[model samples]
Target: MGRIKKKGEAGNAKNFITRTKAVKKLQISLPDFRKLCIWKGIFPREPRSRKRVSKSATSSTTFYYTKDIQYLLHEPLLRKFREQKVLEKKISRALGRGDVTDASRLERNAAQPEKTGKPRYTLDHVIRERYPTFVDALRDLDDCLSMLFLFANLPSTTTVPAKMIARCERLCFEFQHYIIVSRSLRKSFLSIKGIYYQANIQGEDVLWLVPYKFNQRVVGDIDFRIMGTFVEFYMTLLGFVNFRLYSSVGLRYPPKFDKAKDDEAAELGAFKLEGNNALAASSQAPAQVTGGADAETGPDPQTQAQVNKLIRQMREADVEGDEAEVEAGEEETAVDAIDKFEPVAPGGDVLPQPSYSGEETESLFANFTFYLSRETPRQPLEFILRAFGCKRIGWDAVLGGGAYTTDERDPSITHQIVDRPVIQAASQKEDGGDEGETSQQLASNQRMPGRIYVQPQWIWDSINDGELKRPDLYAPGAQLPPHLSPFVQNTQGAYDPTMPLEQQQPEGEGLEDSDEELGEGEEADDSLAVKRIEGAAEGMDLARSDDEEGGDGDNGSFGGFSDDDNAAGEDDADESEDEALAAELQYQRELEAELTGKPVKRDTASPQSKAKVEARKRLAKQAKEEAEELERAKGMLSKKKRKLFEQMQYSNNKKSAEDQKLRAKRRKLEKQKTRAKA
Candidate 1:
C-alpha cells in the first residue's frame, strides 16, 4: 500500500535462506555441507516468518541464517571437499572402465594430498576461529573429552572404525599422562553412568566422564554416523589440548609410544615422556623402563641452564630498578603500597582467592605404594592413584605390565585394594590335609602383615575428601560407608550421610535429643489421672467460694439479679477451672521429675517430655493452619499457577517425608545400639 512492495526486499526474507538453496550455493553435497557447517560452527536456524522468507517454504524445509551461509562460502575446507569429490569421480570412472591401475593411482594421490596440485586442509583454523583463546577451548573441552572417552570405550564396528577408537584411546591416555605429570587432578567420583574426574587447568575447572568397563552394546537405534562425526571433531580438539598441555610442562608432545606394549594393554605405561627439564637434570628414570621404548631422556641440559640464566637476569634487572627507585625517593620507598580488594557487585564475594596448595593436595598417595587386587578395577584405580602422585603402583600379574611389583606379598606395598568378600581362612585347610587348592586359595586370600587392605571405594573416598579415611572401616567384609556422589552438593535441609542426623535435622525434629524426656513422655497416665482428680476437687471448692463472693456483690448492687443466670455462669466457670487445675497438676508432676527425681515419673516421663509434646502439638496446629490458609490462597490463584504451586508442594512434602524416614531409621538404630550396650 505504501508503494508496490518489492519481493524479498527486507525483513526475514532477506535475512534467512533455506538449507537447499544454501547447499546449492556452496556447490557441495548435502552431507559435505552439513559437515562443513558443523566444523565452521554454523547451524540451521529458524526465520521469524518462514512464508515471507521463502515463497516455497514447507514444513519439511529447514532454514539457516543468510549471513552464516554466506560466511561459509569463503571457507577453505570447501576446496578440499570439492577436490575429494572430484578424486572420487575419477576413481569411479577408472573403475567403470576396468582400469584398476588408474583407479589405484588416483587413490594413492588421495592418500598423499601433498603429491596433488591442491594444498592439504586441516581443522586447526576452524578450531582457533571458534575458540579464540586457550581458556575458551578448555571451557568447551568437557563435551570433547566426554565424546572421545565414550568412543574410546565403545566397541569397533563398521560405522565406528577400529582406527578411530584407537585414536580416541591414545588421546585419552595422553591427557591422563599430562594430568599425572602436572598434578592437576582435583576430584573424582564414582557415578552410575561413569566415573567423573575433575581437574583445574589454568583456573578453569574441567570435568569429564569415563564409563565403566562393561561390554558396550552397539545397538542399531543409535546413528553411529552422526556420533562418529562428533567423535572425529573431538579427537582433533583433544589432540591439540594434549599437545599444549605436554608442551606447557616442558615435556615433548606425542611422547614416544610403544604400540607393542599398547597391544599388550599397557595403556599409560606405553608412552615415554621425552623432554622435561627435571628429567634431563636428573638422569634417573623409573626402574627397568629403559629397554621398553626408545625416547629422548629430556632437553639438552645446557639449553635449560641458559633459559634459567635468562630468567634470573630478568629478575635481577627488575630488582636493580626497584633499588634505584628506593634510593631516588627514599622517603616514600620506606612505605610499600597495599592493594585493597572490593566486590564487583554489592554484597558479593570479595577477592576470591585460590585456597588450594597444588603440591600438598596432589601428594595424597605419594608416600604410599599401593597394590590392586585382581577383582578390583585396576585401570581406573591405577590412573587415579598415579594422577594424585602415586608413582609406585602395582597390580595383579594378569593386569598388563609396567607395575613396580606384581607380587601381592611384596613388602614395599603399603595398601592393598580388594573388592572381593573375605574368604574364610584357607590357611586352616592348609594346616589340615588339603594343601594344593587350599594353599593357592590361602595365597590369594591371605592379608599381608602391616599392609592396609581396603575396598576400592576407599581410594575414591579419600581422594574426594582430600584426607585419608580410617582404612579399618573399609576393610574387606566391613560395611563400607555409602559412596555419596562428590558432584552432588549438600543443600540446606537435605539428608547428608556424612553429618550426624541431629546436626542437619530441623530444630526439635531430631531423634533422641532428650533421652530423659522420651522416658518422661511414656509415663503411667493412671497416676496423672489421680492427681487430676485431686486438683479438680480443690478447684471446685475455690470456684464455689469465688461464685459466692460474686453473687453477694451482685445482689447488693443490683438487688434483683436472677439466681438461674448466676448459677449457669458459676457452673461453666467451675468446669473450666477444673480443666485448668488438672493441666497444672500434670505440669507439677513433670517439674517434680526434673528436680526431685521421682523414680516412677523419671522412668515414665518428665517435664521436658511434656513440653516437647506441647511443642509438637503447637507445630502441628500451626502447620495445619498454614495449609488451610494456602488452600484459601490457591482458590484465588489462576488454574495454571495453582496447579504449579500444588506440584511444588507435593515435591517439597515428598522430600521432607523421605528425610523424616531417614531420621527415624537412624533413631531406631541408635536405640537398638543403646539397648545392646546396656
Candidate 2:
C-alpha cells in the first residue's frame, strides 16, 4: 500500500491557488492584484478537477496557477505597492496625532519621487519579459491597438479622466504616423458598427477597429474601470512597440509631438519624424564608399586601378572569344571593390541594416487621383489613401478643408469613390439652355467619361489584392461580391469562390471520362434520329417517282382507257407503296434492336397517351401563369425600387454561392483529416 498523503498535498491542490489566497499572499488589495496580473500577463487558471484542488465543494471559487502567483513575488511593482501602503500608514498616523504640518509634509514626500531620488515604476522590464522578440510584441499588437483606439475615441467621463483620453489619443496618432510614413497600412473597411483597419507590421498582419468619430455612445452596461485598467496596460505596450518599429526603419522613436498642433487637430501631420543619421550613415557608407570615394576626395587610386584592369581583361577576353571568362573577371572585380571598402568609424556599433530596395518599396497606388463624395467618411479614407501613396486626393467641400482639390469635376481625377445610390434623373437644362454649364449644375449620377466610378470598398479591395481590381465589379449600383476576411488562411482542399470549379476538382480525371461517355451517347442518339428521318424521306421520294413513271407508262400503253380505270390503277399503286414502306421500316427497327441489344415492339397508339400529354400541358400552363404573375408584380414597382430589388436578389445569390463554397471547403478538410487519422 502507498503511504498516506497529507491534506492539500495531493493532485492539483498543490498546483493551484484561490484568488483570495493569491491576493493575500501578494499583500495587495484585489484591485491592485488585478492590475499587477494584467500588466504582467498573468491570468486566471482553472484546475482540471475542482474536487481534487478544493476540499469543500464550492463552484464560485476562482483559481490561479501556483507558479504564476509565486513568479509575481519578484515583480518590481510589488515593492512600489508596499511603499505606498507604508506612506499611507505614516500619513494616517500623523493625521491621528493632529499634526497637520507633518501629515502634509509626509504626503508631499510620498508623492514626489524625484526629490527622494527614487524613480517611478515602469513596465519596461515586464514588456521585455512578456514579449521576448519584436515579432512576439507585434503578434499581440492587434488587441493593444484596438483597446487604445477604442479608449481614445471614448468621451471623457467621471470614471475615465480627460488626461487619460488625451494620452490615448496622442499615442494612437503617433502610431498612425509611423504607419503612414512606412506605408504599412494594407486595407480598411467601413462597416455599420465601426471602421476596420488592417496593417502589415513586420510581416504580421495587425487589424484593429476604430469607431466613427463623434458616434461612440457610452453605456452603463460596460464597467469603465475594467476598461480603463486594460487601456492603461495597452498604452505602455503600444509605446514600446512603436519604438521598436520606428527604430527598425532608422527613424527616431517617440517622434516630436507638438501640443499646439495636436490641440488644433492636425492628426498625423502634427508629429515630426527624425532620422537616425548614425544608423543610416553606418548602413549606407559602405555602399557609397565602394562605388567611389566622396565627391571631395574623388575616386580612390586602388579602386580606379582595379576598374581599369577589369576593363582591359574584358577586352582581351572578348578578343580571345571567351565571354564566360570576361563575365567572371567583371564579377570578381565587383566583389573585390565591395570587400576593400571598410567602415570609416572604428569601434562603432553595427546595427542591423534595413533593406531599401526600390522595387520592394513600390507604392500601392502610384498613378491614380481619387475624389471622395460628401456621404463618404473623408478623414479615414484620406489617411488610408495617402498612406498608400495617392498624392492627389480631393473631396466635397461639405467634408471640410485640407483637400488636394475640392472640385468634384476635376478632369484629372482618375477614380471617384461615391457611397450614395445612383441617381437616375437626367441633367436639367437651364433657362439659357447652354451646353457649357458649370460642373455643379450637372446631375448627381452623371458619370464623367474616361474616369472610373467605384464604391468606397474598391480602394480597400485594390490595396488588399496588391493590384487594381476590375472597376466594373465595384462600380456604383453594381452588385458587390462578398468581402471575405483577409485574416483567414486558405488551407489545402479549401474551396475558394474566386477559383473556377474545374480547378477546384481533382484534375477532372474521372469527370472527363464520364463527360466523354455522355457526349458519345448524345452524338449516337442524334445520329440515329437523323438517319431514321432521312430514310423515311428517301422512301417517300422513291414512291412518288415510281408512281409518276408508272402513270406515264400506262398513259402510253392504254391511251383509250377510261378515267375510272386510271383511278383504280392509282389506288393499287398507292397500296403497294404503303406495304413496301411498312416492310422497310420493320426491317430497320429489327436491325436497330439487334445492334442495341433491345427487343423490338410493334408501334400501337394507346388512349391514355393523349390524356397524359394533356396533363403535362396543363402543368406547363400553370407554371407559365405563375411566372407571368411574378413579372406583373415586379412591373408594379417604381424604377428605382425595381433596380434596388434586383440588386438585393443578386447580392443574396452571391452570398449563397460563397457560403456553399465555404461549406464544401470545410467538408473536404474534415474528410482529409479523418482519413489521415484513420
Candidate 3:
C-alpha cells in the first residue's frame, strides 16, 4: 500500500480558518472560543499570516483548522452554554412580569442538565493529539508535572474540589511508585516553596515539586477555578504518562492502591501484586488436556507453557541482588554492580533493563525515617522521597500525624532523623532489651531539617555514611539515587565530628582568606552565651513561672523568653541601652510629678534628679550651636560622606532623619578618638 499522508498534511488549502476568524464565526467571546478549542484538543495554528484570510484585498487575518472548528460545534458543553443563555432570556422575561418564583425556577432548571456528557477525556487521547508518542509526552512533562504536583498538595476549596486534588495526588503517587520500583529517582531538593524532585524514567529526566507539608492555605486571593482548569488537564496528562510508565516496566497500569492503607491525609502505602498463589499455579500449566481433546486444546497448552516461561524470565530480569541473604554456598557479587546490565538488543530493538541489581535498589534508597515532635508538620516530602526509594520511613506526630507505619524508635530504623530545635526524648529504659536504640539516638538527630524537610538529602547522607554498607538492605549499584538538595554543600570541608556544622569549604581554602578579609568578624561572636544551656534553662524557668503565676501576676524573675529569644544574640548590646532608657524615663516622670506638687508618684523624678541633670548640663554649654548637624558629623574627614547623605535624601525623602543623625554622631565620635590617638 502507498504511504498514508500524515493526518493534517493532505488537507485542502481552505480547510482551516484563522483562530481569530474561528472565534468570529462562533459568535462567542474569545475566552469561550479558547475554552472550546482546548476542550476539543484544538491547538493554536502556526500563523500563516494576515494575507491567508482576506475579506478585503489589502486586509488579512490568521486562520485555524476548519475541520477542528466544525468538530467543536458538536461539543456538549457548547449546547449547554447555549441552552443556559436561552433560559437566561426566559428568566429575564418572567422577572419583567413580576413573577419571581417562576424566574428562579427557570434559572435552576437551566443551570443543570439531567445527564452530563461522557467521560471521554482520556490521557492517551490527549497525548496522541498533543505529543504523538510516549517519549514526546515525557520530554515535555517538566512544567506540566511540576504544576500539577504543586496543585495536588494545595488545600482543596470550592473551585479546586477535594475530588480533583485526590485524583492529582493518586496520579502523582502512582508515578512516584514507578520511580521507586524501577529505581529511577535521581536528585531531590528542599526549597522554600516546596521539595523539588528529579527522576530518570527510561533516560528521560522528570523533575517536580511537592509543597511543604501542611503549609498550604486555601487563600481567597488565588483564583482556584483557573487553577482547577489547569489541574483538570494535568490530571489527565499524568494518568496516561503513568499508564505508559507502568506498562514499560511490565507492571499493571493504575497499580492497585490499598484503600485501607491510604489514610485521611492520603499517605501512600505498599502495593502488592494481584491474584496471589492460585493465579501463579494456573499460569504455569499447559492447556492440553488429553488426546481426546479438540485440536484447539494443544495450541492453548503450548501458549500457556510459553507464557509461564516468559513470566519467569521477566521476573529474573527484574531482580537486582541477593544482598538481603548470603550463604557460604553463594558467591559475593558486588551489590552496586547488580543493577548495571550489559546493553543487549532484544528482537532487533534496544531497551534499557527493566530494573537494576539489589545493590542499585539499596543505594537508590539508603534513606532514614524522620521523627518530628508534636510541634512540627509533615510536609509533602513523602512522594519525592519514595520516588527515589527512600523507603523504610517513619515520622513523629508533627508531620501528618499517624501517617508513618511505626514510631521512630522501631528497631528496624537504621538512621534516626530530626530537624532544628529537636526535642530530645529523655532516655527511656528498655524494658525488654537493648537492640537498635544506639544508632537511632545519636548521629541523625544532629542535622537540622530545613523548614520544608525533604528526605532526599537524608538519603544521600545515609549512603555517604556507609549506613548503606549492608548491600541487601540499602546501597545497590548503578541505580543508587543521589542527594537532591541544592542546600547540601558537597565541599570537603574541615572535619569536626564533635560539631554539628554544615558541609563547608575545607581549611586552608580561599574561603578562609575571604573570611579573614571581613576582619574581626572571625573573632568568635561572644554576644551569644557559649552554649544553648543558658537559653534552655531560661525558657524552662519562664514556662514554670507562667504556670505558677496562674497567667495573671507578672513573673518578673522569669518573664517569657519569647521576646528576648526572638531577638536572639543580635540584641546583646542593645540590652544595656534599653536599661539606660528605662532609668531615664523613670527619672523624667518623677521630676514631672515633683514639679506639679502632686504627691510624688512612683514613676516621677525631679529636674534636679539623675534624669534631667545631664540633659541640663549638655544643653547649657551647646545652646548656641544646633545639635551637631547629622551630615556634618558623619562627614568627619571626608566630604564624600556628606554628599552621600545628600544624594540619598534626594532619592528617598521618607527615610528617617533622626536615624541618620544618630548614626552620623556615632561615626564622628569614633573619628575624633582615632585622630587624637594618631
Best candidate (score: TM-score): 1
Q: Which stretches of candidate 3 lie over 4 Å from their true place?
A: 1-21, 39-128, 217-225, 247-266, 270-363, 366-381, 384-391, 397-405, 421-456, 460-678
> How many clashes would you count in candidate 1?
4
Residue pairs of candidate 2 with colliding backbone atoms? none
Candidate 3 at residue 676, lDDT?
79
| Candidate 2 lDDT tens digits, 1-678 | 989989898568989999999999999989889889888878988787888899773788999999999999999899988898889999999999999999999887775532453445677788889889888999998888888888888888888777778878889987886777677787676677678888888789898988888767788898887777788778888989888877776667777777676554556656766666555444321211111123236668999999999999999877887767777998877766633334468744344344434332336666789988877878788778777777788776556555678787789999988887887876666668764433343457777888888997887777766677898999898878667666566644555756664565443222212212223444444334334544674556546664455555523335766867866775676566656766776788789899999988454423333333334434545676577566777889999999998899788768656755665565465556666788
- Choose 1 or 3, whichever is better by lDDT: 1
For each candidate, give its TM-score against the true structure. Answer: 0.69, 0.57, 0.46
lDDT of each residue in 622-669, candidate 3, tens digit only = 542333345335657467766787788665533444434444454455
lDDT by residue for model 1 over 1-678, one digit each (tens)?
478768897888888888888889999998888788777778878766778888888888898888899898889889988998999999999999999999998898785522443435678888878888888889999999989999999998878877778888989998988887777888898888999999989789999999999999989999877777777778778878888877676666788899888877888899987765554334332321232223435657999999999999999899879977767786665454444677778746557344425566688998999988777898899888987888898877678777778766778989988888777865444445544521123355677679898999999899888889899899989877889887775656778787887687776675234443233324546335544555466455655555455445523223456767755665587567556766666677688777887752432445655565556445655786578567668889999999999899999999999988888777777777787788
For TM-score, candidate 1 versus 3, the one ahead is 1
Off by over 4 Å in 2: 1-6, 9-11, 87-120, 187-196, 259-264, 279-362, 396-402, 407-412, 426-451, 489-678
> Which whole-number lDDT from 0 to 100 does residue 608 have in model 3?
28
Give the Cα lDDT of each candidate. 0.76, 0.72, 0.52
